[model samples]
Target chain A: MQKIVPNISVDCVIFGFDFKQLNVLLVERKLQDEKTGETLIDDWTLTGYHIFEDEDFDTAAARILKGLSGLDNIYLEQFYAFGKVSRVDSPKDNIWLKHQHEGFSSRIVTVGYYSLIDNSTVTLQLQERNVKWFSITDLPELGFDHQEILNKALEKLRSKLRSEPIGFELLPEKFTLSQLQKLYEAILGTTYDRRNFRKKVLQMKYIIPLNEKQKAVKHKPAQLFIFSRDVYERTKRERFDFSI
Target chain B: MQKIVPNISVDCVIFGFDFKQLNVLLVERKLQDEKTGETLIDDWTLTGYHIFEDEDFDTAAARILKGLSGLDNIYLEQFYAFGKVSRVDSPKDNIWLKHQHEGFSSRIVTVGYYSLIDNSTVTLQLQERNVKWFSITDLPELGFDHQEILNKALEKLRSKLRSEPIGFELLPEKFTLSQLQKLYEAILGTTYDRRNFRKKVLQMKYIIPLNEKQKAVKHKPAQLFIFSRDVYERTKRERFDFSI
Candidate 1:
């Protein structure tokens, strides 16, 4: 007898920064099913896989990240579970039909996780066919309900960035204030007044001004600031009421 | 070819109030393993079922609530997903392992939802065998990981009860201030100074006095209050911060 097991899986939307734009790691699908045999489809999708019977959700998420990005020791957070019956459509059927399943049909529940990583540390060793990074704002049409998943992840990222110092994950160990502000703008998808933003940052008392400045730039190099873990923890514990 | 499908399911922990204590609904298991012909142990568990392939998570949650509680149009929120591998120990090892190529190892992921309802409305219809309500503080040992699930749900309910007017769900449509305070005390699992608690309630400006008193009480009946939805919404939208 074949045991029918409810399949659990985890999908990670790893967001990285390239100093100019926020990008996400995606993989292209190689359609080999009979319905889409030899069909040249250029669909990019988030890196995900079925949870093995022995694996936990967090373990599955970590394994997927390690296999796809070749990075370890990264922080990942479980955000939401997607259980829409028709989230994954077969290639032969209409794209919209993917989100509709018949009575008691096959179902896949995906737990979404978001991770912030420095693209510079991402080794392309696990780069299989069609693996690439695209600017989050310029993402092409992706397979399944990945677009919705990405949108949710982006929303969580923005909310977290507003109250938390998660932007450090997207920056180098040492960075200038301009680069940090640019990263914030990319994630928030809006611009802030530079002077006002700087004033707010200084008031937060978490960003420490270093004596060093960036070496390269046509204009005068701006001083760099490093995030203080001590102050970050203190601010988080004290719960200062600041809103963006 | 036989199609193998994973069963999706939702379980709800319906919290109710009885003036002084918080209660949850539970049902005893009845299925017996065909091979052993032994009665499925007298293990009480939450009401749950496999999801129809086409149903959304919320839809499935509501369906379960209606089926078990005989109440519709109640408020339910999804809390956590229980996906442990050994959540269900196989009861049919002797029967299925003899002929089955793949053993009875199956993974079931259950999404937990918590609902608040007036205990008076829970018409105990279609109770299988040993269905009953247990006080949250006096719960018996439950089967599976239900104990952990209940703890998590209780935590969410307690945190939400402070900021939102969810206590109204536990109380009757019209309730005295003492009744409301009792619900909060039960949920918070602590005692509060009556005068201070009353002061805080007055400051909120949402709980309006109904100019009525309880008919049966040892002491002079306290004034009744009805939760104002408009004021609650406006307060929640503006400066809504609760930490307890």
Candidate 2:
């Protein structure tokens, strides 16, 4: 058995961007009263686990993500540490925590990490039915402080999207400009003028346009573009603002 | 009695800037053997303590900062959490850890916070002789993983400096343009062309030039300036890059 720290845990907010909306990967948690064997609470939450005694927080986050999604080398970033004393204040959550851990401590400090996954690129070998993706706009009641953690993760992702090329991590290899705009809109929670958005994005040398176009589509085929990591790495400093 | 979590700690990298150089606040730690009462290790380390069970991490960090520096309302930011299994791998550090806490866990996790202080604005009621300021360029070997913590803190500070107006927290209310340029140079560890530096800073509408000059000085009196929070808040979205 892994020597896990009961008081400290690592929670990951895994974000996957569909062509239309931003969705978060969450696990369904069902709790039962140990004494009465009565169902107490059933809710969804960000997938997380207590960290191992000998592992770094980063390693623990990666391990948890891999174990749950069977995806590796995802873009993971540690955003915040949520250590509110009343993090597990919900009576059901408190009871559930105590029932799950052998020596559950009253105060648990959870480190929040946000990860971006290109779902189309890799098949997620999810072995469990309880784990599923929910649109950010429509989320169920989450267990513990996972809701707050998810919110903070989204906020961090938005800010990073504005400054860094992390948005590409959630995108497929070949995509239309409309898909790119929709991705930005989904994450930022704002709609941009189509003409202005294209003009701004086109100015960025890193976003390389390809001659290839969509094949099997009812509507008019649009040109495809791929984000060039080499170009971005070379000229990332020259004001690549995506705040619009 | 206050109950503190022995396994978790909050270490602060308190940074102060004189007109000449950037300085960090560190506390000298002295350790001795329990059996023989022999001096083992004596070195400087970031000032921090285990967090109280009932308080949030932010509250604990603020309380620790106030307790140590006698200064309130300082700019404090949580940068990262340092959790390595071998954080106390040094034999002397291991012994010291066991001596300090009654039930010291083998593995400890520490959340790192960085604080900015204007040394000239308020008198630090440092009740102990162990704490002192050291220049970033000239520093003694720190204890445990404090050196690594400080390095990460500095990296965070530099990136924040490029984007935010946090550098103002370290300087007096009224400062000269030369002092401002030197402050940037000290933190960035690179000298900038004076004319270009002044030109870039002047373009920003926030760094307002006051109709004032130095009163008592050995050299020529330079014009004074003050950072306008109101102006910054109003025009912050218009590219407030301080990369120079």
Candidate 3:
């Protein structure tokens, strides 16, 4: 076991985009109440682990995520640090925590990170640890201040999707413009005029059209396009109005 | 004295705009080498303090800044957490650390925060602490990973200026289009085409043109403008190109 450093932790909010809605990973724990000796709610928490004395926080995050998802080389960005004094180990919250893990001590300040993942690339053998995926709309109350961390991560993700070409992280390697539009609408929870989105996207010099078409679609085959990072880096315009 | 929380600290990168260049507040410390029995570099550090056991990290940050600069209720936002296991207490850096702090036992994880300020609004009565503003360009080597923190904060600030109309944080209540353009150039370290910048800013609904003009100038008096937050909040659009 890694010797956990005192008063420090790392919590990760893993964002996975399915075909329709955005999803997040939460680890479920079954604990017995310390006072009542009764089983408490299987508290859901972000897939978090305590930082070791010798490990970088990001390294700890990657290890925890890899241990949970069996995936590596995921692009994780630090969003915010949730360091409110009342975050955890409160009189009311400590009992739930004491039942969850051993060697509970002083308050912990967590560094929150968010990773946007392509769901198709993740393995599905996550059965031993009671890990589950939930839609962004519906989530149970998480342990500690995890709900706030998840919310902040989602907020950062939404803002990033607007300004950065990171929306591609949530899409496949090759995607139709319609798929791209649907991804945005699903994450932003808003509808867009088809003509406006198409017109605006066509103006982006980085999104290149390929000579590929959908083979098994019922409707008319839409042309596939790939985001070219080279073009984006070379011909990148000032992103003064990404949200617009 | 506040009971300091061990192994965790908060360092603030206070950014001030003085019309011509961006400046950061750094506190200087005199340190002695433990083995050589000689003084080491009088290294500069950010306005920082250790987290108190019961206080919020941000609250500690504000209290430290308030204690250091006598400023209150100032807005400070967390940008990143610097958590390398070997950041401090190494043989190479511990000499400076030994002289500057007390009750130091282990490595620290510092949460970095950046705030933009109009220089005139801050109090100038900072006497006891060896605190001074250094232009971002000519800063000496900062101690304990602070240089990295400052760079990350600047990157965040530049990105923020593009996505949001935050440049006004560095300008007066009323400013000319030229002053606004200069502020952008100073912070971003880049220039924009004069006509293109004017056209783009004029397109913004929040930049209200005033009947007022610059007084007592050698050249023709140019019209001044004010950034209307009321309009920005209400007129926010998809920021697909805020960098323009």
- What fraction of the true interface contacts does model 1 reproduce? 0.20
Which residue segments of model 1 deviate by more than 4 Å?
A: A1-8, A17-23, A28-43, A90-106, A124-140, A154-244, B1-7, B29-40, B90-105, B158-168, B175-185, B188-220, B223-244
Can you give the lDDT of residue B131 in candidate 3? 78
lDDT tens digits by residue: candidate 2, A1-244: 8888889989999999889899998888887667999889899999888898889899999998998878888889998898888898888887787676678677789999999988676456566547888999999999888888998899777866765677878888888899988988898888889998888888888889999999999999999999888887877653322111
Candidate 2 residue spans exceeding 4 A from truth: A30-42, A98-101, A121-129, A191-205, A209-211, A238-244, B30-39, B99-102, B122-129, B190-211, B238-244
TM-score of each model, paired residue for residue: 0.70, 0.87, 0.89
Rank by TM-score (best first): 3, 2, 1
DockQ of each: 0.17, 0.30, 0.52
Q: Which has the better TM-score: candidate 2, or candidate 3?
A: 3
lDDT of 1 by residue, A1-244 (tens): 2222345568899999999899999887645435656564557789887776677777788888998878887878776678887777565324323323322224567889998888898886556467888998788888778999999899767756665578888887888888888998888877778998777777767788999998868999989888887777765532212111
Q: Which consecutive 10 residues in model 1 chain B have the weakest lDDT in total?
A: B235-244
For residues B97-139, could you state the per-residue lDDT of candidate 2 as single tens digits? 7677667567778999999988776556577547888999999
Worst 10 residues of 2 chain A by lDDT: A235-244
Best by TM-score: 3
Fnat scores for every prediction: 0.20, 0.24, 0.60
Docking class of predicted structure 1: incorrect
